[model samples]
Target: MGNSSSIQAADASGFTQSRSLSRSFFGAAALALVIILPGCATYSSGFAKVEQAAAVRDLDGAVKTLDELKLTGADEALHHLNKGTLLRLQGNYAESNKHFDIAKELADKLNAISVSEQLASVSVNDTMKAYEGLPSEQLMLYSFKALNYLQMSDVDAAAVEARQFDIKQSQIAKQNADAKYLSGAFVRYLNAMVYEAAGERDSARIELQKALDGYKKQNSGFPVPASLTADLARIKAGKPAPSEVVFILQNGLGPSLHEATVRIANPNPQNGSSLLSLAVPKLAKRSVPVARIELSAGSAVASAEVVEDVNDIAEKSLNDRLPGITARAVARMVVKNAAVGETKKRSNELGAFGLLANIAMDVGSAVSERADTRTWSLLPGVINMARLPLPAGKHDITATYYSESGAVLATRVFKDIEIKPGRKAFVSDYYLNPPAQAKAPQ
Candidate 1:
């Protein structure tokens, strides 16, 4: 939904002007703006190849392709994040945390750069610049890092990551107080689970309450999870049990970014009334693998509920970023217009060369006007979780990933799941899409 107003905003009186097209270099500049800029790379489509690998359950191939990509600056952070997520899926917790830690550091460093970087972007092309990640993606980085710690049974590190998630969520909320929607229940709930695992009942109870508040704020019509309610009840009864197993399910791929072209009217209305265009990023929806998951440990069975809607997170994060994007686009257009106007004021041979040079620059800008389309493409469209209490010993749990129609998509039997006394077991899985249900990139 970015820069949707580019055309309407350009039609304002500020862009209306009368100029001599025959004598001035206005004709060439207008022509360049109209023809060259629209040819820019609107969005990158190479991620489709990785998705293709994933469709056939080729995890190693997906990671290999993603790793082979040469990335620089902000894109490097995305590289780390995406690879870390894939590694986690491969059950490489230690290696995954290493990459995720690097990603977190890079994200902070890139985000701290001054907004002035956008000015440099006007001339150098936006795609050449660093890629500061979306807030939702940033938050997910921490969530995954915590999950990595959980898988390794490092409660201390996991708790630290959970605290960082809370801090980041608060910061995002403060930045976008007027946003239409922004809330995440899973992070806090997971935090509570970690605290409970660490034998910190008070902190666990507090986090559970916070998680409940987040659900209330969402107001998205989802019922409060009965599992959460039961956990809270047990915590209130001074039963800080560690024999519980939590299954974290990541389901499907989130939406991808695309480009939309906005046609702006010529600044000088007399120049054949040609239209100039701007390219802005947009989010395109896609189908997810499953809506809910059911976990069965012998006779005890429970259904996983949505803890995080990654699709909504991506959409909200983009909407929150639209204001800054629109402002930068407006500023860049103003600079282009001023450059063209100055070219017209001079009447010497050098001025004629200046006009040609400006035309060339416009063409370059058009070629480089690519949208920052890098994201954690392998991440699930939604995250769900189920908790089951079991006796301290090796056990078998079967997880059934299914669709809204109650159709069984995939059934995974996790054998020899070990539960320890006063320590919980964490299991994780992701379903990109049911076999035979994969859709080709549009």
Candidate 2:
């Protein structure tokens, strides 16, 4: 919370309630702050109309709604990220990349802030600051940008993104040695394929190994794709293998943050049933539609398994930062309590004006206690991948995504996929669960 001192605890004891001013005038300023600003707003409520459109696969409508909202300030980065993903899903790769570029620049600028700089903004709340994005969101920004390039058949640009992501994650890993989200194994797996497509076998092999090491090192709760092992072994033999079809699937929606308020016990029981309520952000997991993706390229088949669980990474990422968030909240509440207590003290002496002042102070304290819930809400919860090595020729590929309960949720088919010798072709998709079917009575 920044600039919280703007609310002074001092009383205007001499201000007359009768002929000097209308009774309503006394509370106007305080009421304005509470009424005019979205101090207690959450992401879900703000994005409700747009999300409703997206829930039904009306992506164009969703994009249009977002455009109409014209969100600004700290959340502009997330707005761009949402638009970019929606556009990508619509197969608008160029436009998607343009928006992603804007988001990347904004995030990079915010990331330049030092710890001291952040501490200086202690009085400024999260809603007022530029969003730098969480580690998982930042990582996916690179991944989606690369995927957009790949969709446009721009292997070189994709490779460039791969390298940049590698450098970025390396720096992140060094700074946060114990952060499991630093693994970047999903992105590494993707980069390996990008290198392979670029005819950089040595770089491809190296990245594949790095991906293996990252998966093991991070222990991110996702089992390494068994296909990765087969990939490394085959590449190690240095044989000129036929080109392959790599099916990349982004599965289910990612988790979102919601406010969770906890009431702390009173240090002195005489004070009442509660001391203060601490508001914090908590991850709300999204639906899990695609548990496994079964892919078949003619006779050759491979099952795409989880390379990354974004929900888990996002949860762990937020958990790592909660201590600092909690501490700031505690400090902010202390400031609010002092202001409220001051108003309460002068309420009797100041008469009607003081009572109104007390009411405003109480409202301000509750409104200011809201938790920040912004996030890259459009991202998928899981990244699933499968590889099929076919002889250099045209082949038919079928991909079917399943739920954990083994129900078929979706199926995608790519016809006449051509694979060249010593190269890789990719077929990628994003999936959401079909409308939940009505169940029969038992």
Candidate 3:
């Protein structure tokens, strides 16, 4: 993330360099060389390359590359700005701030004289247009500036630049949803961090939730950073201690059906496990061939599945009764693994069902069609549940079915379910149609 001081430096340095370079022969040659280089040229080619490396968190490379760039008559302000950004990325905040201050001074000088009035008058739209035709090096410079602001906790300013960056990127070529989502998410998260720093707990919470929601909508299950998680726990507990909830599902075979026991493992001493069970019918004539079961919290299935199958064989006469059998599998479920948080309940919708709806929305419209087309087998499989977790909040639930060939055969999302803590929320009654279903109990 970029810091405010570093951002000040980057802006000052970039503008100053542009101005000075415009007047210097060597500066012009350097710019020309950048233009002539292959699109995949090394990072030493342009000023923006340093910024690009910083954006991707490659601080060392960015710093080393910047040092090697022989900028004849480069604006001192720009040099300091680049140096400050690299320093910030390296965690040398004090040094970064010093450089930023120098860049700011240079900027002040230029602003006083109204040097490069044409560039100074560039509108946001013009900047956006220019960004479209910008070489990779220029794009990197913009990225570095945005990141510097983000790190400095000046989210609003960073957002403005980020938006410009996105628009310019789109004008150059079509933008991917993932890329857009990442940029948006980073902005939201930085804003939330700023709120947290300001001691506005409620506002911080809201921003953080928004950030989480945005990430979920994108179907990106990136884990919440530890700092953010700590902030939420503090808010919830009205104190400064960390707490986490873990859900575990243990599967065991019974005489006639498959039994699953779910338990919550709270790290805090004050919290206790909340256990539940789901009894699935076993196959009448043959043993259940359940290779795996996946579960997740907040109305969704788990992130992982219990997959190792247990086999038991015993010699039995035609007239002898079969012996009882038992096998076990385990899965861990948690809220953070979900792409989105719980879904809000709508009228006539149960909590788990509402969660499913949210899942469908997050996953997108093509999911059902894709499921029907046997794409489910290719997708990750989630165990379907009639009962789901909803702790006095919103939740979304989804189940994806996989074929024997490991292709996604179907996917279903249950949306907008509300359930109070210690209460039960039921989901829509649905069943998977499969050859394995006949072998498993109803």
How far does residue 368 in candidate 2 sit from its true spot (Å)?
1.9
Top candidate by lDDT: 2
Candidate 2 residue-wise lDDT at 14: 32
Q: Name the regions of candidate 1 deviating beyond 4 angstroms.
A: 1-44, 122-129, 179-183, 265-275, 341-362, 365-367, 434-436, 440-442
lDDT per residue as tens, model 2, 1-442 = 3344433322233334343444443543354365226464544446756656765678899899888774657677888898998898887899999999999888888888767546433432445556777776788788889888987889999999999998888778887888866778888888988888888989989999999998897687878789778778878998654678878777777876777877665474222212454577877887767777899976788888788888888888898989988887777666555545554564435566655655565555565566778888778878888888888889989998877889887778889988778767777788865444311112
TM-score per prediction, in order, is 0.82, 0.85, 0.27
TM for candidate 1 is: 0.82
In candidate 3 the C-alpha lDDT for residue 372 amounts to 6
Best model number under TM-score: 2
What is the C-alpha lDDT profile of model 3 across 257-327, one tens digit per residue? 12223333335311211121111112212232223333335444443232111111111110121121111
Off by over 4 Å in 3: 1-43, 46-65, 72-82, 98-179, 218-442
Which 10-residue span in candidate 1 carries the lowest summed lDDT?
269-278
Model 2 regions lying over 4 Å from their true place: 1-28, 31-36, 40-44, 48-52, 113-121, 263-275, 342-349, 435-442
Worst 10 residues of 3 by lDDT: 370-379
Clashes of each: 1, 6, 52
lDDT of 1: 0.71
